[model samples]
Target: MRRAPRIRLLLWHASAAIPVLGAAAAFYGPALERAGGAWPAPLDDVYIHFGFARAAALGHPFSWIPGNGYSSGGTSLTYPLALAPGYLLGFRGAWLGLFAALLACAALLDLCRSLRRLLEPRGGPGAASSRWVAWVAPLFVVAVPLLDWSWFSGMEVALLGAVLGRALVAVRRAELAPPARRPAEQLRAGLLAALLVATRPEAIALSAPLAVAVAHAAGSLGAAASLARASLPTALLLGAHAAANRAFTGEWSAAGAVRKLLLSNPYPTPLEKAVEVIKNLAALRVQALESALGGPWLSLVLPLLGAVAALDRRSRRVAVPLLLGAYGALLLVALNATARYQNLRYAAPSLVMLLVAAALGAHALARRGRLAAGVAAALAVAALAAPSAGFARQIDHFARASANIAGQHVEVARRLAARAPRPRRVLLGDAGAIPYLSGIPAIDGLGLGGYRGMPFARASVHGVPAVVELIERLDPAERPDVFALYPSWWGGLADVFGRRVDAVKIEDNVMCAADEKVIYEADWSALAPPGERRAGVIDEVDIADLMDERAHGYAFPSPRAGWVIGAVLPGGGDGAPRFDAGRLIPEGREQSFTVGAAAAFARGPAVLALRTDGGGPIALGVAALRDAGGEARVEVPERPAGRWSEIRVPLRDVAPGDRIRIRSLLGTFRSFHVWLLRP
Candidate 1:
């Protein structure tokens, strides 16, 4: 028994990985350039890791903003650790992640070869033939858009692939080796399993089953040795991790887990999430069958693999497939329970594993008859090239979309940094790319970047965040020098940071710039009361409350707050919009709603200020009435439709004894607050 030549093994791995890397560089390099040099990751969350890695390299563990308290916001410990060195080396994370991905791809290729040999040992028929699973399966996996993106996106997906592949291969080696060699193999498997847990906590489910399988196969003595070797180091590493967590954040689990699992979590219970995971698996099963390989290949590949997994006890390939089934089930359960997408990168390992199995099955079928072999070859081609058309389309769309959204985030941060008197602390829900670009600390209003005891609770709906109470709940020390909000007119944030600073509009958002010294004076006022809101509608009086609120896009403070009546010419934008519903909705006609005033006080010196889209005149028409027989019109000024216009009318001309009648207001109304002044 001789080992394969080292160069041949290297070539095998390199052949599998290089093409994919070349393609990604060719595609995204230009795509990102066209997107104004945005980061290649499809999600802003990817930047958060870059930020965390930088912080960790600076001696702060798991922080988006170093020098601030530790934030357990990072989901996986191993990814940032791997990524940190790149940040310290002063290079783009995409390169380092790609390096990791290349290695993972190589591991996947090795696993594919191992699978091939397991199904068709060297003595078998057509053993000399090209192993389609080894040569072709990787192409299919890399071509899948989501898998491609995940591997390249600077997250843990590629690392997971490499680590999981190592674990599987090592466990198989442990099972097959003689007792003398089994202990070391088992120990390697154990260490890899520990690394998986350290990489992503959810891998525990997958690791546990692999350990049992390896231990069972290795016999009691080998198993005992394996457990000792595995457990001692793993326990120490885990203990150190827990100690780090406790030392910095006073908790054993990352604060991110709580942020993701409890506060701001969506799924109510484990059972419900398990149900969703099961459904997603079924959908994936259907998705694979419907893919380019189509029903014919699935009909052949699935049943064959199922039969082999069930009956062929000696084959090592089935062992991984079985473990994959368990891993995916549990991983999906954890992912879905945490309210993440069940079909995306979170479950990608499982999908790629099946692709490996399917590849083997397809190749093995080719061994039967000439007709069978021809059919297998054609199906293999289709599976590799055809189903990927859909995935290619998806990647293209993702590239464009990620470019715009992620590009804006980076650009805004860059713009902010370019300004005079750079803000050191900023707050926003979309806080991912800002710190990465600006090199400034950030307070994540969304709690994604690691904040402790943020001012919100979990909501019933998945992905829906809770309503924030007031500024007092937010520590004054953590108060940002720059406060920003999306859809700027929302009352919640306005209420929280009201009149304390000047807010300007930037890219459809409100950015409040604070003074360098004394961000807020000791003379700061108590937090204002929230707006009066009920049943999805917040009227003029408490519109400020709605503006200042920090609530999710669902529920009362959500985007669902709206109404549509006859065409009174409605107008709204990112902030709260306002509408003047006519008596009835007409297909295409301008109309107005007359709002009545209850009482009038004698007017001496007064002021009337109204906010309107100025879409139509008479946004607010007020008149003086003194035994008036005819209606009095103020000859309200005309204004344009889109931009908000402040209409402040002075009453110095009014007779001291005259009373005023409140007339109608106008525009597409989301928020219209009218204030009356008297002096």
Candidate 2:
């Protein structure tokens, strides 16, 4: 009998730990295995902390770029500080995430036990009436995938939970302590209150009411002093931090709270927003809860009703639960009113409070005996099963999808780094995984990265992604070396820039150079490839200057045959290779050219040109980068007339090891620059 409660608590804890760890590993393992990627966080925002953590480890300490000084896009100001120690030691972030989960589970269990004890005095239909509240409530919550997923994500989520959990427990115990020790208890609670708000700006709203309630329960004599002590120190720290941020970056909130002011605010300009919230809440809230909790949204009501019923007799104050509920509701309202409504991440944190409430409710029902406990258990399982199963599927699916997308981004970043005049800058809309992987100083096209007050950040208000707009509007001096804006988020590549060359697509991300000459449609000629192969390759002779990739090693292979389009390179000018309005050439073997000196390889056939000499589009042979001064070679089966020539060169002629002595005659035209249409 002595071991029974311990055994039961262990089982409850196990229930929480096992499923969450399994789910996180399932979602995160593949990402960790891949280079330049992290375990896919439930929110891309988590990487903001990861970036800061990396910076802190490197001695730059919170700056994304080392030696560039401190700048952070992280929402949690202190979270990077917490992660610094783990990151400095060079532990894989995923393993650290597991450690955090364990700590969070321990805190959660403790919080539930405290709630069970606190609510025990309340009779009738309250959660503490049941003996199993401590165990069942924790089990229900941990089994839910959304809470676990967010908990293990590389953020300060678990730490915050632990802090809040301990504080709530302290608050409960202080109410029952003897009068002599009440003053000291109140002071200690005040310090915890201070720590809560000081740790996170968002925590202020959530922790404020709970602190007030705790002070009130401490009685009227020292209540004001306790609350004031908590508030003053927290205010001073926040003031100092904000002052420092303003000094450095000219912003009050380094988290970019002002950028999307309307969305972040619970109340927007129009009075109708309040009404809209009330009206639409009924329709959308249930769906949102279902999506986040991955189960019957009704299950949440169990805790809520229990909290209300337990509070009915005033045996114990359910302040923390109510405060958490209010915080979630307010956050939801703010997000719903703005365009920033996301995958319930903002609301999921509130679930921790609900779990406490459920424990109180479960205990009440269980106290009614075997029949009541059995009925409550049946209801709990039914409510939770679907969401659990659904979330599992979501984890698996996200892992698979992110691999394809993140892999492509990584490939592009590597290629750009190696390209001559190697670019040190990139700008993209998907700011997290790509920037982390793309071994370069990357800026958020949305201005969500430390460039908080910029025009792009303003334009992205209401969750509208405006990468192309920002790129187009930015001054020429501010233009990054590489641009990765998905056309779907903005507009088409051609419409935004007068012309874009080196059309590159990595998974969902699309990239192109502003001054690119030619781009190849990968699918125009693929081995039955998808339209996604249309992610173009740089092929054309660039109209502007770029240290071409060909001079490096991005070589395309030979093609079977070639056909003349509206225009071709070397436009019938023997003195120089002038690609005439109409010209054709044969596809050669491996896409390499043997010049007078070292060999140079072009990436692909220049299938499409950004600009045409005439009003219509022109075709140029793929451009080749070299050590400069290579004697050009133009090989066709038979040199044909300039206009309307049917040119067909066999692949056998340009076999490997056949060195074509290239001489650059001022007016000589060359054949298609490359054969294959891929890197």
Candidate 3:
């Protein structure tokens, strides 16, 4: 093959720039117009980055709320800091988003140039002119709907792609460089490797190929020495991030990973978590191929090209390990249940890595005979055409999603910001826009922002009561004054402890969790101990108050094990909420609890006054109430089920430390409040 004419680097970049920026403009123009000339981001998460950026610019780098301590909620520590410059320049609202768009555009353009460098031929006979690869590669990436969507979404996806793309190019250049200059090029690749990991931790798997190339760079020192020299920057940056998190939150990883990843959730057993991981891994692979790809069958092109590339002698080492590392990245993401969410953003990096490898495979085939070249051309055309066909629809979805976020989250935040005596604290299930736009301190109900991660994450799994227990323990000054939540997201917690103040509803909602998000004024007066006291009452156990239950040594089987908190309000009217928030025992099952008092128990016999829903026969016993006696039992008759009733069991020598066991011997029932009284 004759040598192909070389184009100036500037002109090559312009060629890639025209298409990539044009596509980004195509998406943003309609999206901004749909959001009423406002730059509403495609997802709520974009505002999270903006919020952290503002904090960083204001001299509080990791603080989610100014004056608040550091929070490890954000997944990317560097992206936010990178955006801080925009905030420092007064890029509020839409301008901040525009700043991000420009940065993203530059990243994509750089990525295109890097990709071109990777595909160009290094002198060899019949190497088939790679001039076509330059124009075709950038065009193909631009034609991809998902990549273009992410480019303008104001997220870190574009930056991550560019970093990894440039890192690969640098590695390839170092590997083929003259021995005298190899070390310098290897160092450059290593620096990009550090940036790649800082942008997104999972990219560590994607960066494995770079690590190998760096360690094995020609004319380098020993593998360990070379690897260390290249990796020092990454170690220091990652260590600083971890140390900051440990100092503020007493945890090493970011709060987002802890709360969002499936492995971090509270599972009953390790076996159950293993089961979920396997299911997630299979589902992620299927979704990546069938749903994320422009066309379902286009998925076959990746593995086919990868196989051909792996079989080629010259590229085998890079191809085989790159393919395996990309797979490892995919599996690592499977540990996050949201691996396919938000247009599969979590899985996009791995998919893009595979695409880059496939591109190399295509380049390898083109260097072969006419038949192989023809095959690569056909597959490439088909792959590019499918994504191009879907660009129109993806752009429309992007516009609508942007509009949904603007009309709902942004509008609600504006209202909150306008309120007089501005809310001291706002509790939110969606933590991004509310705190940033409203300038209010936020308690992230999902534990992704200001809330302490592990406790909130574990409480989230156990249901509302567990969360309420944590909330009530907050310092009085830090308690939320207003709650902004999607009604469906918080299971009965809002209805139980809040009075509805307003609701923001939107149309054709495809991004926010629900069509309507309601605001509530926090109300806890109902949870206080009731005013009226029963005759001869010595100590009371308020079952409805989770904290009180904790103090009284409450224990029950799992929510799935027939025990759940239950409550009733007569006629469902606006009267006092009958508090009965503890174990709902099934028929023939027994439950037990301990009763403690602040003062010493009176030296006399006492009566156990139990408040419950009337069922059939009930047996109440004290576990070793008297040291010299066996368990004491009492039987009570059934009453109607609609109203609350009290049953008393006589006790002798029972102390605060003793346990009281209740058995619903006949019919399923609820145990609400218990009191120990002088008889």
Which model, 1 or 3, shows the larger lDDT?
3
Off by over 4 Å in 1: 1-14, 92-126, 129-132, 220-253, 261-311, 314-343, 360-379, 452-477, 487-491, 498-679
Instruction: For model 2, give the 10-residue run with minimal summed lDDT.
Output: 520-529
Q: Which candidate comes out best when scored by TM-score?
A: 3
Candidate 3's residue-wise lDDT over 433-489, tens digit each? 878888888887766675543345434544556556557556666678899998787
How many clashes in each structure? 28, 26, 0
lDDT of 2 by residue, 268-347 (tens): 44555555666545434464455554535555654554554355434235544454654454464453433223344445
| lDDT against the true structure, each candidate | 0.51, 0.46, 0.72
CA RMSD (A), model 2: 18.5
Tell me the tens digit of each residue's lDDT in model 1 across 128-189: 45354455545755655555666665567667666766666676778778878888887897
Candidate 3 global CA lDDT score? 0.72
Candidate 2 matches the true fold with a TM-score of 0.60
Candidate 2 vs candidate 3, lDDT winner: 3
- How far is 576's C-alpha from truth in model 3 (Å)? 9.6
